[model samples]
Target: MSHSIAIIGASGYTGAELIRLLATHPSFEIKALAANSKAGQPLANVFPHLRHLDLPDLVTWEKIDYSQIDLCFCALPHKTSQEVISKLPKSVKIVDLSADFRLRDPAEYEKWYGNAHSAVEMQSEAVYGLTEFYRDEISQARLVAGTGCNAATGQYALRPLVAAGVIDLDEIILDLQCGVSGAGRSLKENLLHAELSEGTNAYAVGSTHRHLGEFDQEFSAIAGRDVKIQFTPHLGPFNRGILATAYVRGDSDAVLAALQSAYEDEPFVEVLPKGETPSTHHVRGSNYCHIGVVQDRLPGRVIVVAALDNLTKGSSGQALQNANLMLGAPETAGLTLAPCFP
Candidate 1:
């Protein structure tokens, strides 16, 4: 029998993406959708693009019957996710797409998120949902914490190198370009078309981005010490995708080899041929992460560029991938759609 699922916070981008993917899934059924802000409205009215699918109408979370849901995708905002997830039935598996439970250390979560973690106990149990790296943990986890999109893209480019001791950990720099949609569906003066269309500029410079916490936690765990990378995320004019160029101290070939060995069996992460760079277009609208490696002219320097659809491989797609593992579904089920390229 197909697993019945409920999507909390179903009107946002990640929530909508989850619905789009699960709409055709063979073994997953969408039974409930909760979007408090747009409750009682047809999902089609909130997102006309999804009009074709037969989906449940949006309702407030209080009205959903959680006992009937075999799995839940919690796509609520950060603080809100922890609050909502804390109340979910233990029998219901969850893949949280917010930053709430991604950090294991409650203090660390407060340090970056500026609020105390309300669900400290649950936070301790969440497996970091980087499907390729935490496959075993996610398979047995009831709550899987999805990584930040920018963080996921950066890790795909450098995790193997960090784990293999092939690169100097102290000198890592990740220059990222992300589409405006990463800001979510919220209204912002900067996100207005008039302000965002004409040019591209970097935000979260000086290592101020919140995803840095994820980098610190994951890379440190792999390296057996604290690892900090220089990360600067730029908002691009496009609608989706994240391209991260990582500058590190290492032999380009060695770094590439490490990445290749790490993801050889991974179905979603693809390492391009050496010296060939990846473009956002190649991974747009799909749960694929493409990495390319190149040697910089400067001795002992290497550049690794990784690209993925921020909403797909970075968030909802990642959530679903983990959910599949938690529920004994094929890890790649409902996730094999080819990228949409122009």
Candidate 2:
């Protein structure tokens, strides 16, 4: 049976990405499209490339009755998702592609986002939506919170090693570079065509990036203790990918074996052959994440790298993966599209 689905913030990058992937999805029916500011307009008017699909016109949340919807994709921004999700029908399962529910502790959420969570009750009920790491929880959850794009990339490289105790928990360092789309569709002077076209620069330096909360949460959970990693993110000229390099203290063989063994059966995450390295170009525009592990020249150290399309595997794709699990459908349904290449 086809499940009815809605895209709550349908005018942004991840929202449009959800539409693109769901358009060809076999068991998911796009039933509702909502965007507060763009209400009453046709979805295609805002996203011309999606003119071929049949989707509801942009409507205000108050205009649609949630009774017919089986699942919702909350793609709104931080803080906004919490408020909007709090008002939705209780029975509808949600895969929020926002920071609203990713952090489990309300205090942590406030610490990183600078606002008290308005939906603590629901926040307590959400499952982190890193499909590879939280499959069991997501399969049984009514609300699955997606990870930050950079966070997802970083975790894919280091989580397995951390879980296996193959890497030194205290020595983790991540250097990540992300494409422009991860910034969202908002207009900003720094993101203009002229400014970003030929330059590459870093931001959120010295552990100032917010996704560190995710690394702190997941890494600490796996180690059963406090774990912190130095993280820095850089903006690149490309439009859609993330490449993260994690410098860890561990045997290269053990790190490789751990990642290969952990993701051995998972469909979306793959540990590449030895000596190989991940690149954003390789996994661009797909739900797939490619990870590579190698030994550094210095003994007792390993260099782990992972690549993925931030908008897909990092956000909407992960959301759909969780939705499939929640709806009791095949875990990989509507998500088999391979990475785009030249």
- Tens digit of per-residue lDDT, candidate 1, span 110-164: 9999999999999989999999999999999999999999999999999999999
Candidates in order have lDDT scores of 0.94, 0.90
Score residue 316 of candidate 1 by CA lDDT.
95
Query: Per-residue alpha-carbon lDDT of model 2 for 1-342, expressed as tens digits?
Result: 889998899999999999998988889999989999999999989999999887889998777778999999999999999999999998899999999999999999999999999999999999998888788999889898999999988988888888889988889989899999999999988999899999999999996688989989998998999999999899999999999998999889889999999998988888999889988888888899999988899989888989999999988888888899999888888889878887
- The regions of model 1 sitting more than 4 angstroms off are none
Q: After superposition, how far is residue 152 of candidate 1 from its true place, in Å?
A: 0.2
On a 0 to 1 TM-score scale, where does candidate 1 land against the true structure? 0.99
